[model samples]
Target: MSSTETVRAGSGRAGKRRTPGRAGRAHDTREAILDAAERLFAERGVGEVSNRQIGQAAGQANNFAVGYHFGTKADLVRAIVRRHTAVTEELRVRMLARIAEPGDLRAWISCLVRPATRQLDALGVPSWRARCLAQFDTVPALRRIVVEESVATPSMGRVLEGMFRLLPGLPQEVREERGDMSRLLVVHTLAERERALHAGERAGTGWEATAAGLVDALAGLWPAPVTTRPLPG
Candidate 1:
């Protein structure tokens, strides 16, 4: 082939390759970016990492990764929140299906906590994710996503609502107050214990051991109101 013809052929191939038709590749790239962001954010803190850093962690060739896929840092935060929500949803479904009739509040609450605690156990806060969740409260965009998607999503809320119903009767204000505290206690314990375990403290025995201890501690905040059994009618 003539040199000019060879050059033209190569140019045509290059143009075709650059036609921006990599839907699957784009999807995979986006997924990788979020995975890295979550790992980093959970380990470090959202403020400690940048989009360029996230791209690097994801093994991306370009530094403009998060922008290319998610458009903004806040969007990337939402993406991570969505991933957590997805895991929570899977557990929520299991809890919903498994909670027996005449459900014990403690047992039902366990269903919600057990799966998520597993995620926390497996995660090491990886610097990025730890930092991110730590700073997560100050980030308006990210905070909203965390509460709406990651925290109070429907299934979990319903579980909490049921627990509220079974709670020892308190004034409306107190019930609401304690209800929120009880749920937060579970989340707080999971995060705090995970942090401790990451700091090299041994988690007592197995998961049941650790979780049972937590259950016992948090259970103290919620007690059934004691009253005299009414005489038979």
Candidate 2:
């Protein structure tokens, strides 16, 4: 039944049950659409996948179901990103509370990396969320949504503040440059591992190990000497 449909024919007990049943089914349908869209968007680029295709993959008889639930392509993408970011945000918040040493670069870097890896780990194998986000990050508009939802959060602000406090001498240009590099490294690296795990190929290590390596690299990266400064633009 569609979300708009009402079970008016039933009485009392049956009516109460059917009302909740309809809502339950609608919630299930929305999740089904999200999962289908994530996989399709990951396997095929966001521009390549149509709403009709996502609806079909989600087993929706109505071709317009995607629009009905998500409104537009950007809305759909934002929803997908929120699905993951919300979980990661919670993870980061807890990790933040555990920070005994605000000066520990590794601690703060782990705050940045481990939440994502832990979320991916909880998602199990054959997942496409990480790869879907990687694809989205390549598009400027979609990348903004990704960053707005994931990076521009209160917990993330604290993480960046904690991390940067240790590197007071780093040049602004290099800081911004390395910031971009860190994002790319974490995103693409996890996406690659997710791709490999989904493809039954060698992923080398689990999410925890991957996160540890990323944390180690980023720990070194933040403090590395800036040799050449960019010419004034």
Candidate 3:
């Protein structure tokens, strides 16, 4: 090869080596920002937290660090949801694959609840994710972000599909109502347990036990017969 060609080849190899290091640093910065944002948002509602505060909490001296990395607060919330959803999705997908009976209500419900509880368990004590999600559930805009990013995933879609298949006889309106109920139940339950753990309070049981309790409660809730009220004459 010519001298010029050899030098160009060496430069190309060096660029390839440097690319990943740069990318890794950027990824680490983004993750740090996400961790700080999740904690702050959980403790103080999303509206009360600012980008500059998040930047400082993440150890970024640059005032624009959060904005540069994550754009708006809504975008940052979406990023945090996406970060955890990937892990929960994988867990749910694995559980889905092992489901033997399509009509088993508890099995389908397990797909919905266990993955999230399991993720929290994996996060260990003093986790902020469940509380972060609970906060998101309260804000209309942030809740929408959570629904779009996490709820709309393929694995979650499949979980809902399997769940609906088991409840074919349920009224459409009731099914929708129960769907909202299930979300509330799971979110609040996990958030409460997370808060307890964070405060050094006894959570009463481990995550597996919590998941089992939630599954049992949902199994009952999902299949309960709808009662009709007579209209006033």
RMSD of 3: 7.8
Best by lDDT: 2
Q: List model 1 lDDT by residue over 1-233, tens digit each.
A: 23321112223322423225555565676778888887777677778888889888887756665666676687677777676667768877777777786357677567556766666555544323433454565566666776776667778777767666776465565566665676556555555665666666665544456577766665566664545545559
In the predicted model 2, the residue pairs found to clash are none
lDDT of each: 0.63, 0.87, 0.84
In model 1, which regions exceed 4 Å deviation? 1-21, 101-103, 121-141, 196-200, 224-233
Shift of residue 158 alpha carbon in model 3, Å: 2.0
In candidate 2, position 190 carries an lDDT of: 94
Q: If ranked by lDDT, best first, what sequence of candidates would result?
A: 2, 3, 1
The lDDT of model 1 is 0.63
The CA-based lDDT of model 2 is what? 0.87
By lDDT, is 2 or 3 better? 2
For model 3, the superposed segments whose C-alpha errors exceed 4 Å read 1-21, 229-233
Give TM-scores for every candidate, taking all chains together and pairing residue i with residue i. 0.70, 0.89, 0.87
Pairs that clash in candidate 3: none
TM-score: the better of candidates 1 and 3: 3
